[model samples]
Target: MKILTIVPAHNEESTLDSCINGIRNQTIETDILVVCDNCTDNTEQLAKSLEVNTLKTINNVHKKSGALNQALDKYLLDYDLILVQDADTIIDNRLLENAVKEINKDTKLGAVCSKAGIKDIMSSK
Candidate 1:
């Protein structure tokens, strides 16, 4: 089973490295694709350094959704399962493995939402 992680990024050079690294460190081997949308930083360069596939777009449309759609159109055919992730989001190494195990066992899970947090939300108050 082939899995592809599509990360939609826009000027997320600082956090992108960590996000990609987290995916790379996973026990299971999966393809990683970073979609650089209207980026003004070195997001593309960093992704290239990681030797992961990258897609860049100059025109912005649906923010996260648009970038994901573009990636889906281009790379969806190559992967059996597609994981849509944010540029700044870092997931656990076992996330994909666990998800695949559960899916294979039950085959009834339509969706699963992972844990997420915003930076400095408590400090804002």
Candidate 2:
């Protein structure tokens, strides 16, 4: 199954490198789409340097949901599964593989929520 990961970024240069590296190191090959939404920073350049698929927008929607929706509308039909990932989140190499396995086994499973570390949660909040 083909999986597509959509990463919505806005002035996330500091974290984008790690995130892109993590995605590149995943055990399962995936088509990554990094949408640089109304960013004035070097986010697009960073993504391009990593050689990952990228898109840039100037709409200034300013919401992750809007960016995600734009990506979905553009590329949803091409992929079997769509992963909406945060720009700063670092994922395990086996993350997508494990999730796909579980999802395939149970068609009734509607959603899966990941548990974040306490420090991460606290910092984000």
Off by over 4 Å in 2: 58-62, 118-125
Q: For this target, which candidate reaches the highest TM-score against the unseen true structure? A: 2
lDDT of candidate 2 at residue 98, scale 0 to 100: 80
lDDT of 2 by residue, 1-125 (tens): 89898999999898898788878888888999999998889999999998889987657465887788788878989988877788898887888878788778888885555555423533773
lDDT of 1 by residue, 13-47 (tens): 88888888889887778899999998889999999
After superposition on all C-alphas, the RMSD of every candidate to the true structure, in Å, is: 3.7, 3.6
Q: List the residue pairs that clash in candidate 1.
A: none
**What is candidate 2's local distance difference test score?**
0.83
Per-residue error at 81 for model 1, in Å? 0.9
